[model samples]
Target chain A: MQTVIDAHNISKVYNPDTIPVHAVNSVHLHLNRGEFTALVGPSGSGKTTLLNIIGGLDAPTEGQVVINGINISELKPNQLINFRLHNIGFVFQAFNLIPVLTASENVEFIMLLQKRPKAERTRRVHELLASVGLSDKLNVRPSQLSGGQQQRVAVARALASRPQFILADEPTANLDSHSAATLLDIMEKMNREEAITFLFSTHDQRVIDRARRVITLVDGRIENDSAATQIRH
Target chain B: MLLKLAWRNIWRNRNRSLITMSAIASAVLLAVATVSLQQGVWEHLIKNLVSLYTGYAQVHAKGYWDEQTLENSFEIDKTVEQQVAGTPGVNAIAHRLESFALASSGDKTRGCLVVGINPAEEENLTRLSAKIQSGSMLESGQDGALVAEGLAEKLNLALGDTLVLLTQGYYGSTAAMKTPIRGLLHFGSPELNNQIAYIPIQLAQYWLDAPDRATSLVVGLEQAEDLPAVARSLKKSLPKTYEALTWKEMMPEINQHIEADSAGMYIMLGVLYMLISFGIFSTLLMMLAERQREFGMLNALGMQPWSIARVVLAETVFLTLCGSLAGLLLSYPLVWYLAENPIQLGGDMAEIYEKFGFEAIFPATVKAKIFVEQTLVVLSVGLVLAVYPVWRVLRLNAVEAMRN
Candidate 1:
């Protein structure tokens, strides 16, 4: 399997010289193509921090985070932004849909920034929103949509750029059982049908149960990996 | 899409947006109105002053401005007339022969400026015929003299009264004459009114024994703005013996006076603009605070800081444009109304204006530059205030910004 991400000895130290707090200490990890993996840990266990570094939203104090054979730590700010636009997608726990944009416009924003053709953007927006069961809510603003529906629109937005992988930080933490289950079903179907990789950080047991592989962290270090689901699907 | 998002975002907090827009609009409207009135008053004062005696420009013997005497008067030859006439902006030229003379009627004797003019040309240039307070305008080839109202009052002379004028003429010649007061001309300026007397040019030449000679040619232009250009052209074409001077050169005191007065107005405008900038900045700061998480999400989603800044700037520009355009549209009718029917001054202000020989009224000018300049100034304030929010976005830390 092609390696999508290769992070080696990544350490993030806050206030290194005085009362240093090791947020993520010398953590090594790899995520291969076509894999649905979860980074599970308790609150403040550096799962979100590691995900942030892997997604290039942050920089580590030591070592490098390599995504698709390019060391993102070495890239300039502008280059990293361009790389992320082309290759990475993000889903915040809050379903951070732009309040002003309609559901479809939220999804279309990434492609717009990517400078995609207008026809292709329109086609993909329709297909993606329809696939996420938000076709009826395409013209609705985030304030007018339910939490579950808004999250689904966020998912569609993450997929609009056709990135190498999607980083979902606590994707189902805020949802109830039914909505979480429904969101999982859509994400599972997309992963299985389109072979799009998904990396999520969650403490939810339900989210852990569905992931093919899970890496559990404690005290900013990985404590367990489910050996039975080590192979990429 | 960027513009659409910006537009929608502003309307999301409609009340806040409206407040900001109102602030900008009010500032622009007030600024436009204030400048319009200032320019109107200044133009009116300048027109009154220029037409009082000196036209928009004057052509005199090179040394005549320094020494007002019959020896410095130049002959109105064909070359000089043609050169002055060929100048593009020169609408009309009124020739004058000016000298100091003592007038006595019965008991009172006063020194006054005696000006000889071609009645028809003078009337065309300065509208001298319209200034007649009592009696009739001076006719061409009339042997009568027109005394200014103040001068006539001082000399205690009425219409058709014999006023004696005694003065030295060309080449040390003693000039003495008696003529009837043909008209009493009203002068806005007390000094000019107290010291001016007009007689026909031919009669003046005959009395002074200076044939075909005039002290200066007062040149009027179609528009006041053309005064400088016409003066420059005339100066270039005129002989070294002649000097063409615009009203600005002829009246440095007025320029200095305007400059001194404008310093205070500019300070007031500066304070107004500062308040306007603060109003806009407060709105931006509030909006930014409200949308911290949204900006963070955008930042995390691979949207460049520059892109986010562009969106914020777009919002600012939209608001600024809306406010400025509305203000500009609203100002036209308001200015027009004020200009058509000026605000009359009363009380002490009216007394002061009258003392300066000006009408006591506030009028607004309906000029394109007032609108364009005020719009630019207000828009620039918006753009300048936008920098604070743009800087906030440029340095945004997504993790921290998203925390709340």
Candidate 2:
């Protein structure tokens, strides 16, 4: 399998001078294409920080993150933002969809930023929204939609740019059990059918159970890795 | 898409948007009305002062204004008169041979300004016929004089009475005339009413023994704004020994007064602009604060910082333009009404204005230039304030902003 993300010796420290707090301490991880993986941890275990470093949203204090054969840590801020736009998709815990746009426009916004042709963007927007089972909710804004439906729209928006992988931080934390199961089913189906990679940081047991490979983090360190245990040693 | 986004964003908080727009509109309305009234009053003053005696522009020998002696007078011939009359924007020209002289009736002798005028041309240039208090306007080539009412009173003279005028003429020649008073003229200005006397140009020139010579040729203009261009053209077309002078140059105290008033007006306008700037800036600051997370999300979604700034700038442009247009629409009728029906001062205010030789009425002017100028000024203030949002967006830290 092609390696989509390769993060090596990544460390992020907050307030290093006055009171150094190691958010993510010397973590090394790799994500391959089409992989459905979850980074599971208790509270304060640095799952989100590690994900942010790998997604190039925040800079790592110590090491480098390579995505699609380019070292993102060495890129300038503007260049790093561009690189992430082309390679990574992010879903926040709060379902951060632009409230002013309808579901269709929210999904199409990424493609618009990519400067895709109009016909292709239109076709892909329809396909993505339909794939998320939101074909009827295309014209509905986020304020008018339920939390689960808004998250589904956010998922479609994440896939609109055709990114190499998607990083979801607590995607199911804000949903009820039934909504969470439905969202996980949709994500798993997309992973299986479309061969899209997804890396999620979650404390939910359902997400951990559904993920094909689970990496457990304890206090900013990777305590156990299911894929590493099975393949590497 | 940016424009669409900006348009939607403004309406998202409809009240906030309306408030900001109202502020801009109020600024424009106040500015336009204030400036229109100021310009109207100034124009009225200038018209009253210039039309009373000095025409919009005057032509004389090159060095005549500096030395007011009879030796500085120029000969008025058919060619000079035709050349001045043929200039564009030159409506009419009044030839005058002006000098200081002693006027006497019966035992009442007083020093006065003697002006020799072509009765017909002076009528067209200064509307001298309109100011006649009694008797009739002077006829062309009639050997008669028009005495100002105050001067006539002081000299105890009446219509059909002969007044003696004695002065040193051209080249120290004895200039003397005894002309019958055809009319008594009233003037708003006390100085002009007190000492001015007008006689026929032919009789004055013949009495002064300088035939066909005039001390000044006051040129009337079709439009007051054409003064500068007409003066420049007259100067260029006339001989090198002649100069054309606008009324502002002939009477600089009026210009000085206007400039001083404008300085005070500009200081007030500056304060108004500062208030406008703060009003816009505060609204923008609130907008930025409210949309911090959305801006961060957009940045994370791959929209460039400059693109977000463009959207904000576009929003500002729309708000300012709408507000300014609304202000213009609202102010037009008010200005037109005020111009048609001027506000009249009462009691002490009327007396004060009259003491300064001005009418005690305040009118507004409806000028396209005023509207455009005020709108551009408000728009510029708005656009300059918009730079703050662009700067904030460019320096935004997406991670921190998203936390907010």
Against the true structure, what is each candidate's TM-score?
A: 0.94, 0.90
Candidate 2: where are CA atoms >4 Å away?
Answer: A227-233, B77-91, B100-113, B127-137, B145-168, B171-197, B232-240
Tens-digit lDDT track of model 2 for B154-259: 9999988999999998979777889999999988666688899998888888888888899899888899888888988988888888888888998898899889
Best by DockQ: 1
Query: Tens digits of per-residue lDDT for model 1 on A1-233?
Result: 99999999999999999999999999999989989988988899999999999999889999899888999999999898889889999998999999999999999999999999999999999999999998899899999988888899999999999999999999898898988998898998999999899999998877777899899888899888774255233
The 10-residue segment with the lowest total lDDT in model 1 chain B:
B186-195
Interface RMSD of 1: 0.8
The two-chain DockQ for each candidate, comma-separated, is 0.73, 0.58
True interface contacts reproduced, per candidate: 0.66, 0.44
Regions more than 4 Å wrong, model 1: A227-233, B133-136, B153-162, B187-195
Judging by TM-score against the true structure, name the best candidate: 1
Model 2: residue B398 alpha-carbon error in angstroms:
1.0
The lowest-lDDT stretch of 10 consecutive residues in candidate 2 chain A is A224-233
Instruction: Give the Å error, residue A229, model 1.
Output: 8.4
lDDT (CA) for every model shown?
A: 0.89, 0.87
**C-alpha DockQ for predicted model 1:** 0.73
Q: What local lDDT score does residue B310 receive in model 1, on the 0 to 100 scale?
A: 94
